[model samples]
Structures are given as structure tokens and as C-alpha cells.
Target: MEVDHRIRVSDGDGETTAGQGGVVGVFFARCWLRLRSVLVGLWCWVAGFARKVGRIAREDPRRVAHSLKVGLALTLVSVFYYVTPLFKGFGVSTLWAVLTVVVVMEYTVGGTLSKGLNRAFATLVAGFIAVGAHQVANRCGAQGEPILLAIFVFLLASAATFSRFIPEIKARYDYGVTIFILTFSLVAVSSYRVEELIQLAHQRFSTIVIGVLTCLCTTIFVFPVWAGEDLHKLTAGNLDKLAQFLQGIGI
Candidate 1:
């Protein structure tokens, strides 16, 4: 009988008597990949976001840059939660909520209450629509397609109706359109289970809440800057440039 002499290797915290380096290499590679993901996220914020803010910074460099820094730092910390092993789910929810609140606050109202209210309403609407669609689909055995189409049409009509009553609706028509799309789109996307829909809604709302809080806290404590400031900086720059041009023209 011939004896084979290839030693088996295991990954037991460097306790393998054979000392194979392959397992160690693999473990190190995984760690590196995770770190790289976080670094990529940071670079994305700095390169794309910071530069845009910096352009606005030229007008009121200190305040604008400070606000931008605070917002980005908070956002980055939120993103890190997703990349890390234990905290990713919470991070995702927080990031989504924060982003939603930020967008709504930028356009509609500029306070924590407004941000929270819009996000909560959006989540509730999504949940209710999803649950209803699920029930209709399960009962009809059609997987909710018919219900979805009807809901979509109804939402569109409702948005149109709101356009007349709410001037903001007409001013920002796409906002309502987006909300309608997202509300029903989830039904088709989800498994059409009431429990699942409820869970999703909870997650959506919870994340939004966390995100809104993070944004508000960061704004107040760290570098509270407003959209008006952003607009003001940009406008002032243009005005200054115009004034300089007029002076050159001897007007």
C-alpha cells in the first residue's frame, strides 16, 4: 500500500500544525475588502459631494464648508453602519430615513417636525397600500397585478386632484408622482404578504426616524446650515460677479 503525504490544512487561528498560508491569506483578503468598501464610500462623499459644496463655499467659505462637513460626516458615519458586520441593517434604515427627511426638508419645510411627518406619512401610505394589494392578490390568486394597476391609477388621479387644492402640489408635481410610484411599486416588488408588508413598513419608518434625528442633531450641534444659505451663497456670488462686470463696463 502506497501512503500519500499531502498534509491537510485548516483555518484555526494559526494553530494548524502544518501552517498552510492559504487560509491566512483568504482571511486577510476578506478583511481588506471590507475596509476598502468603507474607504470607497468616504471617497465618494468627499469627491462628489464635498466639491459641489466647495463651489458654494467660495462665497461664504467658512459657514458653507462647515455645514457641508457636518452633513457629510454624519452621512458617512451612517454609511459605515451598513458596511460593518453587526450594524448594517440599522444603518440602512437610518441612512434611508435621513436622506428622505433631507430631501423633503429642502423643498417643503425646514424643520425636524416637517421632515419626520412627511417620512412617516410616506411610510404609512406605502404600508397600507402594500397590505391592501397583498390581500386583493391573495384572494384573487392573481399576485396583485390588477390591484396594483388600479392603485396606481387612483394615486395618479389623487395627485392630480391635490394639484388643484395644494399649490405646493402643483409647484412640485413630481413629488406626489414619486410618492405614488413608490407606494404601489412596493406591492409588485414585495411577496404580497401582510406580515412582510408590515415589517417593511416598520423598517422604512424606523429608518426614517433615525435618519431625521441624525440630520437634525447634526444640523443643530455640529454645523447647522440651511438650504437658504446654499442658495444665498450661490446668488451672492453671481451678484458680485455681475457688479464687477458692470464696474468694468463703467456703468
Candidate 2:
């Protein structure tokens, strides 16, 4: 009887050990599969990115060159602000020139010109309106000025927001309208210090102009990419491809 009991206890211990081993094996197998999947996904992403770079190098070197030119232009703007004594007084606001360049620059000269002009015109209009509004509000005395300003801001904001949806305005002058709204808000809201508003507007306008000119010069002078040319090429290529396909199908 004693020998049988000892045998049974040993059998139970062996079964438990085997069960734990099986569970551990399964866990490790699942972990390995997950790790392998992750590695494969990472490899695929790297390969795709490498292929894209190669394609760009082979087929569209101009795009890469244009990007480099943009970088050079931005660098020049930064250097001008940092090194020039005339811009030193503007301090951190000098960065606005860089911002404007980034915003206005496009893949093509026409697009850049369109956006630059829009931004400048919009800002000019908004600034003038803000100045006029400020003058009018001031005459109403301290008591009524805040209330009147609030009403004015509300009305302008609402109008600007709604105007964005107009098809004609949105097509060409959308950027301009958006800029007007933004500039209006900034200048109008900051009207408490009316004395400094004009200087601020001047500084911003000059910075924007500098950015626009820089973008235009670089885009035109340095390996220019014309939208019209690109469009022509694309249309021609598509037609050629279609003709080839039709020929292949005996059509």
C-alpha cells in the first residue's frame, strides 16, 4: 500500500511539470510570431521608402533640387535677420519673415505669386479696417468703446467665416480672405495699445514682403519648376500611355 501511494504522488508531480512546460512553450511561440510580424512590417516600410527615394532620384530630380533651393532660401532669410542691424530691432518678430516665406512658397512660381499677393493684399485691407475701427471706437468714450468693439469683432468674424463658403471667393481669393480674417482679429483685438499698432503692422508687412520676394527670386532663378510645363508633360504622358494601351488591345 505504501509503495503504491508513493508511485501515485510521483506520477502527479510529473504531470504538473509537463503541463507547465507546455504552457511556457506556447507562450514563447506566440511571442516569436509577434516579434517576426513586427520585424517584417518594419522591413517593408524601409524598403518602400528606399524605393520611393530611388524613383524620385531617377524620375524627378528637379523636385529634389527645388526642395534644396527652398531650404537655401530659408537659410538665407534666417541669416539676414540674425546678421542685419536693421532687423535687430525687430527681435523675435523677425521670425515672421521666415514664416511668411514658408507659407507663400509653392512648388511653382505662379502658385507662389498668387498666394503671396493674396496674403499681402488681405493683410493691407485688414490693417486699414482695424485702424479705422479703432479710431471710431475711441470717440465713443471708455464706457461704450468695449461694447462697440465687441460687437464689431463679432460681426466681422461672422461675416468672414460665412464668406469662406462662397464658391467664387473660395476658388481664387480663399487664401486672401482667410488672411484678412486672421489679420483683422489680431489687429482689432490688440487695439487697446493703438499707439504701437501702426508700427507692428509696418513690421509685419515688411517681413511678409521680404519673404514673398525671396521665394519669388529663388523659385525663378534657381532651377525653376513651371506648373504649366508640368501639366503639359502629364497630359502628354497620359495620352501616350492611353494610345499604347489601345494598341495593345487591338483598338
Candidate 3:
């Protein structure tokens, strides 16, 4: 009787141990599968990104070069602010130059030039008007200055908004008109604080010019990409594809 009892107890213990081992094995197997699935997803993303980069390099090398040039130009402009004392007085406004670069730089040379020139010209004209308006308002005394300035902003903005819709101007100078409105608003509104409008305008203008010149020089000198060239190539390629399709259809 005692020997039978001992054998039964031993068998029960062995069964429990085996069951625990099986559960542990299954848990580890599930963990490994989850980890493997995550790794595979990450690898697929990396592969897709690499393939896209490869396609861009093979199909549009100029685009790649232009991107690099833009990056270099931004870096150079940033370095100027950090290293040059001339930019120190600009305070937080120094970032305007960087913003200008980002806004003005285009994939094509002519587009960059057109946009940059427009921005510079608009800012110049707006700055002068803002300064003059502020000076005139100041002569009207504090009580009347706000009213006069408000009226001036309203009139100028209305005119600019209307002018933006003109066909010839819309085609080219729309961006300039937008910038003019923006500059005028900024300068005119800030003038009430008695901040030196002329100095502020000069700094903004100089930084913008720097950004524009940097972009223009880098794009023009470094394996320039012309909008006209890209348009021509695209047109030719489309025509050829159409011809091939028509031939395939026996049309």
C-alpha cells in the first residue's frame, strides 16, 4: 500500500513540472514571433525609404544637387548669424534671414530669382511707406495717431488686396503684393511702441537680401537647374509616351 502511494505522488509531481515547462515554452515562442514581426516591419520601412532615395538619384540627379545646395546655403546663412557681430543687434529677428531662405529657395533657378526679387522689392517699398506713415502719424499727436494709422492700414490693405487679383500682377507680382501687405502691417502696427522703425526695417531688408543673394548664387553657380529645361524635357517625354501608346494600339 505504501509503495503504491509513493509512486502515485511522484507521478503527480512529474506531470505538474511538465505542464509548467510547456506553458513557458509557448510564452517564449510568442514573444519571439512578436519581436520578429516588429523587426520585419522596421526593415521594410528602411528598404522602402532606400528605394525612394535610389530612384530620385537615378532619375533626377539635379534635384538631389539642388537639395544639397539649399542645405549648404541655409547652413552658411545660419553660421553668419552666430559668427558675425553685425547680426547680434537683430536679437530674435535674426531668424528672419533663415525664414527668408526657406521661403525664397526654389527647385528651379528662375523661380527662386523671381520670388526673391519680389520679396526684396516689396519689403523695400513697404518699409519706406511704413516709415513715412509712422512719421506723419507722430506729428498728429498721441490721441489722433492711432486713428490715423488705423485708417492708413485699412486703405493700403484694401488696395493691396484688390491689386493682387489683377491678371498680369497675379501671374508674377502676387507674392510681392502679399509681402508688401505683411511688411506694411508689421511695421505700422509696431510703430506705436516707439521702436526705431527705420532701424528695424533696415535690418529686415538686409537679412532678406542676404538670404536672397545666397540662394541665387548657390543655385546659379552649382549645376543650375532651369525651369524651362525641366518643362521641355517633361513635354518631350509625354509626347514620346503618347506616340508609343498610339502605335501599340495600331491607331
Task: Compute each candidate's TM-score over C-alphas.
Answer: 0.49, 0.78, 0.80
For residues 18-55, write the lDDT of model 3, one tens digit per residue.
35556677799999999999999999999999999999
Candidates 1 and 2 compared by TM-score, better number: 2
lDDT, candidate 1, residue 217? 57
For 1-251, candidate 1 gives per-residue lDDT tens digits of 99644346566766344434656776899999999999999999889987887777685655664557446645654663556752555534555654664564332125544545555565567657656656665666565556665665476557645565676754544454455456556544564433555666666667666665655555555545566776898999999999999999999
Best candidate, TM-score? 3
Best by lDDT: 3
Q: What C-alpha lDDT do the candidate models reach, one value each?
A: 0.59, 0.83, 0.88
Residue runs of model 2 more than 4 Å from their true location after superposition = 1-44, 241-251
Candidate 2 lDDT: 0.83
lDDT of 2 by residue, 87-206 (tens): 776655578779988888888889988999999899889988987788888899988777777777889989988998999999999999988988888888788656687888777777
Candidate 1 RMSD computed on C-alpha atoms after optimal superposition onto the true structure: 14.3
From the highest TM-score down, the ranking of the candidates is 3, 2, 1
RMSD per prediction, one decimal? Answer: 14.3, 5.1, 5.5
In angstroms, what RMSD does candidate 3 have relative to the true structure? 5.5
Between candidates 2 and 3, the lDDT winner: 3
